[model samples]
Target: MAKKVRFYAGVEIDKDGIRHTWSADAWQQFMDSCKKESQAFEIRGRKIAGQCESCYSPAVFYMHLTKSRELSDWPEAGDASGSVSNLATRRDQTGIISILEYTYLLPVSGTPYIALLRSSSGPMPSAIADWVSLKSDMPAAGKSFELQPVLRNDARQKLNESLGVKSLEVRFEGKPDPNSTSSIERAAAEAASTIDESDYANVKVDMSISMGRATVVSNSTEAMRKQALSILTNNNIAKHPIKDMLSKGWVTKLKAKTLQANPESDKPIIEPVDFIKEHLTEDADFGSMKDDEMTPEIILSGMLEAIGKFRKRSNEY
Candidate 1:
């Protein structure tokens, strides 16, 4: 089995913000930055980072926004990780208008696939749709939700000025899907960088495409073929690019998974700190309950308990 490799890249966005542009050199820069940051100290999901796997240039920087954009309202965030969550609650309706976006970059086949996801708080309901709306009745926003980070690809320039190379061949790892790269390239053309419902519904992604070939190297060709097909088909990029790749005997079959499913119970879930308190007590899975159904007293009590935990952590508040 080939070694499992993942890259976390962060690019500094201008005041205008980073657009969805995932390109060859752009992704390379991101991985380089991440490696540099992790050289001495380690953080979330840290592991043994291999030798400088940076084949591209040291131009791009990958940024994981641990904060929110609405909270980035001011012009200069300037090294502040951003208290987006708190600012969001105070915002007009980050509760409704705001969303939680989680992005992942999977490095395979020497290529990168940026997974972008957008999740929102439950929306308001219509008269007759109350019961039905209780569940996830909202439209199923396709694979890429709106307002994904926009990346402006400067692959050629990055390669020449930064990476210092000629045309370096690139591929989306694990799958020889051309559209994976195409998707990233396509995302770069969102035109406007502003956030509006109309455009936000569709993310602008370019560099986040799958860049690589379907590769599974093993002692057994059978195992290699199966593993490659599993990953390629799972990501669904195979159908678009390398249609002829499947024509090969190595690829036996392709199958798409069924649609998956979420909820909006928002029943005052307990935080990790709370769990530690009550001396690691057990209570109702209130988060599974109704948000509107929660009482003021319950809310107050929970806050009090959380404060107590904070006090304990600080040795007094």
Candidate 2:
């Protein structure tokens, strides 16, 4: 499967300490400087080992994450002749690991877009920000920069969707600690004391209820279930209990049902890389330009165009 790229927005503070979004012009200047001075930069106290390849254009750069470190020893493993042996530790031995990763940067009039190839061994967003900062124009007093992911709307949309709940079932089971200062805990303690002070320490609350639009069904004690739906929905029948449970963390087991005619849309969460690729094509009409293999210049051009389209979508929304 092809790897996906995660997107981000670049924000920078100027000498006056005013925050501003980076622009394409800003990115262009940064990349040009990087091309001119593509020396190994330090991150996490480690510098690029050797032959640091700095591939850059107006909007992108390939970060060669090569590092050298002392190799103390190797674990017991079979050699080429198929004989297992415990390798001895060698403090003087050193090893080098090389990794090639790409990050695309394209800033609009506002914040710039940064797209990075997502990989298990790739640098994190914060590390990427630091890497870019190193290549950035010499910092003025108070000047700094940051890179943040362009989050998907799924989380917000899911909150509003509310599973289109038609019914809700909740089960709460646990003993509240007597020492807890929470009002709920105190209420539980009081109820346990009323049941039997001798057994208060062993008391537990096991309550279950199922609520529909206009009716609630439960065999549990009336007081325990009383006003539960009200407490959850704040007297709003149209609201779902899930929201309350999420906010309060009071509900233990939850079973929610939606109308069969209008079933809830529980779309699978798209991976960051896949999400970006699909949007690039759907929203940006990014076609053949998304080639499997291309020259550095071509890749930069394609990414630059795609980012512009993304900026438009970002503005429209």
Candidate 3:
């Protein structure tokens, strides 16, 4: 049998700062109208306030199902108006009970209604929870409601069975001083000066990139992962290579392997030469370097190159 889905109805408010309320009679009428149309209750950017000169912007109110639960007899705004009216009346008489299931006011603007609902619940599905937490915002506008926890563990397990990864750490040096305005000024001043490669030798940019093991069970689909990373990058969560590194498809592939491998039995995958080649500046002369020839300076230079490419590509996009 196909899995059942349940949906709940809520009010959506448009405009940045306006409030609307439904009178008992108006609410009943609205419910009746929804039932007549066989549609969930929605206000299409209509002005609710009387005597207000400024028109409220268009907004949409709609119903959607919760991620984990499946319940029956969810009142449909247009198809089951009577059922919804009856439920609302009962809640009013009984002083608010759970018979109506979930109901909340959706603010007109500034906050996303779906995000507000998600916030009330526990952790979101693993795929998005981290990215959502990091961005501390709803997914970008058009994509907001599309994020659904549709990938079940069985599917993930199947994917896990096909892929493997090796856990590795990439360390880079020579980060700039965030607090030093003078350093920035100096760089600006030196923009026209002759290049001095040795001046950067003592500069320490201490950073570590954790190439986390991927697992089928906890992993999100590649598309979802990429979306999450894009959101992070667009929001400027971290500088360059950190953001760029995580966005790589290989990283996702590696993570899947890492997660599936037995910690005690599987050996970690290592490919220093491949890693360097992918991330390093193509213009740089590596001089027939072998995997064993990989140096800290070379790795750091590659990382910096990757960062530059990421910045350039992002600007182009």
Candidate 4:
């Protein structure tokens, strides 16, 4: 899988009622400085929020870095063995410091639809101890952020300068699927062709199963499309896993039904026997068996054996 590069910053307000924003550059500089000073910073009371802006359809994100940490390690330099002493001999220490942030995502001028993030945060003073003792007074936000970070191919050239990351060429992992348009715009244009209702229904059910939730009832086709896209993209479901799940689930359901059927009857149900016979016929060794050789007793034994093998394979997967 290709790795994605993301830019982030901290925003905060000080006790003196002054607000500050830290750009991605500033954050990177601070991190470098920390490394030079042989110290580490820890995030405290981290909170994040996201909302969709109406006009440009831009995504707005907010984050609060309530506190910071100053960390120090003992024996500043490693011993001759290139290993530091154990915890008993080591003197590691850290302290919590004050910091806060207010982040904004706004549309960039000229690029009417594109969103640009401006992050602000308070500065950390060097006077603070590298390993001062302090208690955490920040409250937990108790919320999670679920937004997927999107890096548009078009914006790569503009962002590469300051971000210092190379632009990634959007290349397919394998030969493009000939059945579907390889480009999003072309796919959208092609989708105008009439589609079967049964196909739509199957897609809805598959999306619901992939998300592990019931599909939201919606009258709008656009809404349904968005829901399905969100589930598929965020979950990153591959084709093989989905196909495997469907096949296994189908077999499991059929096995359950077969076991439940004819509980009151002395003889076994025909469904399981038929299922076993179908599988056995697929085997090269068993394919040579004549119809007359498959007696009722043989069928029952084959069904039991098939069921055992099916369960073992299922467990492995």
What lDDT tens digits, residue by residue, belong to model 3 across residues 154-193? Answer: 4323332433322322222222222222232223224413
- Candidate 3 off by > 4 Å: 1-140, 143-166, 176-201, 205-274, 284-317
Task: List ranges where model 4 is wrong by over 4 Å.
Answer: 1-46, 49-109, 113-223, 229-317
* Model 1 Cα lDDT, one tens digit per residue, 1-317: 01111111222223343323345554455456455432211112211121122222222223222212233432221225554444434546433444333222322113223322111211101111111111212223211111111111332122112211111111231222222222322223332233342333332222211112322222432332223222322232212232222211111122211111113542211111110111111122212344443332333233333333333432210
After superposing candidate 2, which stretches have Cα over 4 Å from the reference? Answer: 48-111, 137-140, 152-317
**Number of the predicted model whose TM-score against the real structure is largest:** 2
Model 4: per-residue Cα lDDT over 1-317, one tens digit each: 11111121123334453434444553344334333222223323322222222221122222211222122221143666897553324433223232223222222112212111211122111111111111112123221112222222322212212211111111111111112211321232234223442232122111011211222222432332333222211221212222312111111010101111246864333211111112111111112354435322333233333334333432221
Cα lDDT of model 2 by residue, 10-128, tens digit: 66867886767677677656655555444566766645321223445553344433333323323354556787654433222323232343333333434555554322223444455
Q: Model 4: how far is 122 from its true place, Å?
A: 19
TM-score between candidate 3 and the true structure? 0.18
Cα RMSD (Å) between model 2 and the true structure? 17.1
Better of 1 and 4 by TM-score: 4
| Local distance difference test, candidate 1 | 0.24
For model 2, name the residue pairs that clash.
107-112
Clash number by candidate, in order = 33, 1, 14, 13
* Candidate 3 lDDT score relative to the true structure: 0.25
Question: What local lDDT does model 2 show for residue 55?
Answer: 45
Candidate with better lDDT, 3 vs 4 = 3
